[model samples]
Target: MGFRAMVCHRFSKLVLLSAAFISLVVNAAPWPDGAKIAVTLTFDLDAETIWWNDADTMTGNPGSLSYGTYGPKVAVPKILALLEKHDVRATFFIPSWVAEQYPDAVRSIAAAGHEIGAHGVRHVSPLQLTPEQEAATFSESVRVLDRIAGKRPVGYRAPSWAVSNATLKLAARAGFLYSSNMMDADDPYIHNDPPGLVELPVSWVLDDAPYFWFDEDSWNKTIHSAASVKAIWQEEFEAAYHGSGYLNLTMHPQIIGRPARLLMLDEFIGWMKRHEGVWLTTGSAVAVYVRGQQGRSP
Candidate 1:
């Protein structure tokens, strides 16, 4: 063959080899066995603010109160009942104030064999606070959660999904083992931050808060209809079932506790139970499993 043709052939071979290697690297990561799907049901209990405070008498409707209409009184019992009925455990992310005010409720969750983690001290977003302020808030939250649960919280979900670099550092400094702040990926992976906390990326698409709080107009129009929401959930579940990826479903007691909303939740749970090989567990359990796998790998 001519020299020019030989050079072109070698370049083509190199390109093909590089592409094959890249593909292998992308698909080489092993997913967890047994359907490779872990369904984490996380509830954010944040009802301590003025709009949600039982003592607060705010007649006019506020943005925060828009979602706060569903409080502990309406949410806790239903959630407990659902968990018990389904024989499933969940992670309840409670604000420090809620833990203090509803000790009985918190105790009930712990007694039910579920995991309890810190949501925040008050329901304030982490982005709103300066680094120093955020650190102080995080420290107090950890102390309060530990006091309430009788153990240091191993996980955290930033209030409003509001996270920053400083917020992540604060979480690690506070000794959290995992944080569900980043939405970069669907799988649970470790972030090499200072405290080296694991990042269990919770999908905003899987959460009900954004629909209710952020898109009030659209949510109001579709709040009664569970078809769209359920379809997306089922699709994600099926994809994860096939791909062996993690499926995390997030909800709030106040939002999903209403009679109509509860029906939607029930339907979704029913659908989930019909499937085989799905691992329904708490966020902490999934994190622990992933960490264990990492430890065993060479």
Candidate 2:
């Protein structure tokens, strides 16, 4: 390589490095009440709806249904109790069918002061539906949640993070404060296709299900150790903490409910709490904060 070219490349890298450092500096604002970073722990209470359609109800294996039933009946309460013990609130995304089947579970989550968001009607992916069907499904899920939770939910998380451009717009039109399904950025950004909706990104690395949800009867059959999952999650949290950005940690009840796994969850929450300058909050609330910050220079 030519000396001049090498010199120019070095200068370019220096400029890029400087720009990156400045970007982080500008985005890092002291969180409200002097928190260092924002943390959102979200649970998808998709019990039974994952496999409880009319056909499944009539002829499905009782054992398949049992996995879904385990979530609401055994897992949610334990998760709630742990949250209650810590006096921390979280966001729970519930499919409409699950809400219909387990209204008491939804009610209990609400009564405990946790935020509820629509996850869909039958736990089906939007990609599988046409635009029209996706719109209808989103509306129906919102309606069911509003009816059962007695308040309109202001957030939406498409199951499996499966979404199309139009599906997100539908969510904005439904008046959601945020959509927690995208993975485009490490932090939140604004989505304005339907106008003024926030995107609080979620990562599979930050989700417990991808690591812990293994079933011998199905294709997914590799359960990771709780310790390994905890280690990676903490590493992600540390990066977010240093960046002074948001961390959206996703979890599912059935996946993280086992005693050993729940202990990992508990310690995760405890670790975050021990970090003196952390804001542990729900997704909707973080959306509010990010929206407020958007207008300001970052």
Maximum-lDDT candidate: 2
Q: Residue 239 error for model 1, in Å?
A: 1.7
Candidate 1 residue runs with Cα over 4 Å from true position:
1-33, 48-69, 214-224
Q: On residues 170-270, what C-alpha lDDT tens digit does candidate 2 reach at each position?
A: 89877888999977667666664555688878888998877877665686568789999989988998888777357888888987888899998899899
Find the candidate with the highest TM-score and give its number: 2
lDDT of 1 by residue, 167-262 (tens): 888888787888887776656765644424677787878887655444444544334356677777788888876663677777888776777667
What TM-score would you give candidate 1 relative to the actual structure? 0.80
Off by over 4 Å in 2: 1-29, 52-59, 217-220
lDDT of each: 0.70, 0.79
